[model samples]
Target: MNITILYFARIKEVVNYSSEQVSLPDEVETIIALKSWLSNRGETWQKLFSGSGVVRAAINHELVDDMATFDEGDEVAFFPPVTGG
Candidate 1:
């Protein structure tokens, strides 16, 4: 399946990319799996999605958690936790 992945804030900076289209293997059906798949890209991806950081996710513009399931053409976004002063 093909999906559009987006990065925001520090996540974007760390990844050095704002967005891209990803083609997932059939086994990657959930957000958690997608994260793991992306993490395999390299050290930078591993660091960004290491689960130690406060990463937030959204699917198709609606905030979602790791268990969220997505299909082809879905828009998935990852970002750091929002903060305000």
Candidate 2:
């Protein structure tokens, strides 16, 4: 399935990309699975996305948890948690 992936804030900086379109492997069915799949890209990906809570995720603009399910054409975003000044 094809989906759009968005990286925001420092996550963007670390990934060196703001957005990308990718075809999800069949094994990747949920947010956590997707993170694990991407984290295989390299140490950079692993550090940024290998575990829970390090970054926040959203699907179609609504924030979601690790277990959240996404499908074809969905927009998935990742960003660090926002903090007050």
Candidate 3:
């Protein structure tokens, strides 16, 4: 399925792109799987999504957990945890 992936905050700087359109292979079905798939791109991806960072996700503008399932044309976004003072 095809999905639009967005990067925000530190993720955008790490990934080097604000957004991208990706065609996911059939094996990828959830947000966690998507992260693994993207991480395979290179060292940078691996480091950014290694689960050691406070990464947050949203689908179609709605916050979702790792198990969230998405379909074609879905907009998936990745960002760091927000903090306020």
RMSD to the true structure for each prediction, in A, is 1.2, 1.8, 1.2
lDDT against the true structure, per candidate, is: 0.92, 0.91, 0.92
Q: Which segments of model 2 are wrong by more than 4 Å?
A: 51-53
- In model 3, which runs have C-alpha deviations exceeding 4 angstroms? none
Which digits, one per residue and each the tens of the lDDT, describe model 3 over residues 22-54? 999998979999999999999999888885897
Report lDDT (Cα) of residue 51, candidate 1: 56
Worst 10 residues of 2 by lDDT: 47-56
The lDDT leader among the candidates is: 3
Each model's number of backbone clashes?
A: 0, 0, 0
Residue clash pairs of candidate 3: none
TM-scores across all candidates?
0.93, 0.91, 0.94
Of the two candidates 1 and 2, the one with more favorable lDDT, higher being better, is 1
User: Which residue pairs collide, candidate 1?
Assistant: none
Worst lDDT window (10 residues) for model 1? 46-55
Put down candidate 1 lDDT per residue, 1-85, tens digits, no spaces. 9999999989999999999998899999898999899989999998878858978999999999999999999999999888878
Candidate that beats the other on lDDT, 1 or 3, i.e. the better one: 3
- Model 3 lDDT, full chain set: 0.92
For model 2, what is the error of residue 72's alpha carbon versus the real structure, in angstroms, after optimal superposition?
0.6
Which 10 consecutive positions of candidate 3 have the poorest summed lDDT?
46-55
> Per-residue lDDT for 5 in model 2?
97
